[model samples]
Target: MLPLTRDQKHLVDQILAFTTDHVNETGPAVFTVYGDAGTGKSVILAHLFNQLQTAARTQPNSPLTQTTNYFLVNHPEILKVYREIAGQAPHLLKKDFQRPTTLINQLAKGQTTADVLVIDEAHLLLSQSDHYNNFYGDNQLRSLLTAAKVIILVFDETQVLRMKSYWTEERLERLLMPYPHQHVRLTHQFRMQASDALVTWINDFTHGHVHHLPKDIGTHYDLRIFNDAEQMRQTIVAKNNQVGLSRIVSTSGYPSTLDGGKHYITEGHFHLPWDQYNYTSTPWAELPQTIDEVGSIYTCQGFDLNYVGLILGPPLTLSPQDQLEVHLDRYTDVEAFKRRADITDKQELIAVKKQLILNAVNVLMKRGVQGLYIYAHDAHLRQFLGAK
Candidate 1:
């Protein structure tokens, strides 16, 4: 069973009730659930989905009898995690859940249909087609909503990580403007075990905003700043040895590639490799060797970690004015923005391009549940954070 907070449970109940009441209504019904990174938005959705599935199968004349659920998740890691939960021994959620690319192809070919659309991590939905141009004409969210009778989106606009698919809250709102929609808010931090004060402080810290920190910062939360990457890795290894689930995440200083040859990620005296490739059936975090591999935002996003050791790359460094700047050139995540490379002169794309990179960095910073350790590649940032 999926666990949910009081507010989350109530929101799930309301959404289910509203969805059941409008099972046969004309047009499409839309509702949104917004929450911070770890407010149990996906967990609630999972619980409600299981219940509805059970009702449709075992219960006679159930309101959900006509309701068919087609679950969509844009992020691959998150998609697999949900599938693992829904399918235990055989580990198959093939019929109910889908990846965006797969769904788009099926929808284009008229191979599938559903009465209700369930989307998790919907903020990762792509506004534009990918490099292969597989979904050139299909705006995913709009297409999914139009295909179903009712659509439910669990989203956090701040988590948008790619230039190809980054849709702002305003954009999503505009899309739903024509439909009657209800909004729900989730305001709890269940992923991180740290005190509320510490989570708030880390949020403020990542944004470059000021946050008053208590003198006893390390008492409740195991937050720390390390001067070197090696020490940071060792500390995380020790933490994992004790409690497990510790991992290291880094910015684009170490480029990731799929050339198929083993390549080690080396910086000065510190050396490690990128994670081994993982299929949809296996997650990198679940493997023991994953600790020796450095994870990027794409791999680590939307997942909880016992402790996080983040290596700040040059892209995230102090400007001459002492204000922090996110340098695009220093961010080696060109694979993510390769689709936008041809449109160099487009002003709007360039503006959001930087914001998307920063958003990825923000995700890694907020991933730790128990503690967050830091390792800065830039000398200035190293000194700056070490002072904290």
Candidate 2:
């Protein structure tokens, strides 16, 4: 398991102690742990799960015995990586982990009860059900609350990637307002080994409070803006050789074709393909062959990397209003927008699409721990980013 910082350990203590007192109380209790990418929320959660198991061993009527433990993770890659990191706490490991859709299916079949549910990356929880999960409530959050006595939802709104997940701090509060809940804020960031200044720089640029901020240049963050993708690729590859993990992540404005040959993405002169998702249950960042393929938001979210080569594609462009905005016509990931067939309001529809792209850019921009290398596909964006 990941070593928790002092801040993380304190949060774990609060959660474990809180659960012990309120586990068997009359009704459901909700707690929302709020933290951004590098705050180490997942590790703290794992520790809480461990403490629950320990309590179960000593006390037969402990929360763990009465309420089943379920860790809801988003992806198979994340699940595989989490299980590996969770280590010896098998009862606290992936054995107890499941996806929300799986739980929704179980609930639909009348197979679910009030258990203790701990959700990681709760931002990815779908706010709407597709045709297959028609029986699922208005969203998974409703169903999760119904099925769990104690619900701990760990979320970061900036990490919301898709269109269907409408979870915000407000939405979560509205859901929890009916129940007594606790709010824990993770103040220390250990994921990137990143300094406060660097995170502020990222926050500033991604939030559009500033445009074209320069790298801090020789201190904590090794951020570089590249005029060329190949040069950035070479730098990331060399970094991966020196230390451990590095990746080339792009906005989904790049097109891909699986055709007959090896599947690849062709964007002008750049011919990188996507990594296969079904490969041997290994983390995408750990796989050696993944160096040749590009990663999307789904694959890279909730994972950290040493060197990140970011490719900003067609969707991101400096507008006529002299601001960065999502150009829906230039974007390749139109499938997400197309799914919202019921939306009749023009402005709301456009706003939703823009936010999705912005959130994608935000996530791609923040993945690096040691370094960030960026290459914007549009010359205007490159010029904008390269400037201080």
**Model 2 Cα lDDT, one tens digit per residue, 11-124:** 888887677666677657877899888788888887887777666655676556646667787667788876775566645545567788887777678876545778898998
- Who wins the lDDT comparison? 1
**What is the per-residue lDDT of model 1 for residues 30-122, given as tens digits with 9 covering 90 to 100?**
889998787888888887777667766667788877466777888788777877776762322557888876776787788976777778888
Indicate the worst ten consecutive residues by lDDT in candidate 1: 209-218
| Number of the top-ranking candidate, with TM-score as the measure | 1
Regions of model 1 farther than 4 Å from truth: 89-94, 131-133, 208-219, 339-348
Model 2 misplaced stretches (Cα beyond 4 Å): 61-66, 110-114, 132-135, 214-218, 257-263, 320-322, 338-344
The per-residue C-alpha lDDT of model 2 at residue 100 equals 83
Q: Assess candidate 1 and give its lDDT.
A: 0.75
Instruction: Give, for candidate 2, the lowest lDDT window spanning 10 residues.
Output: 209-218
Residue clash pairs of candidate 1:
126-165
Cα deviation of 319, candidate 1, in Å: 2.7
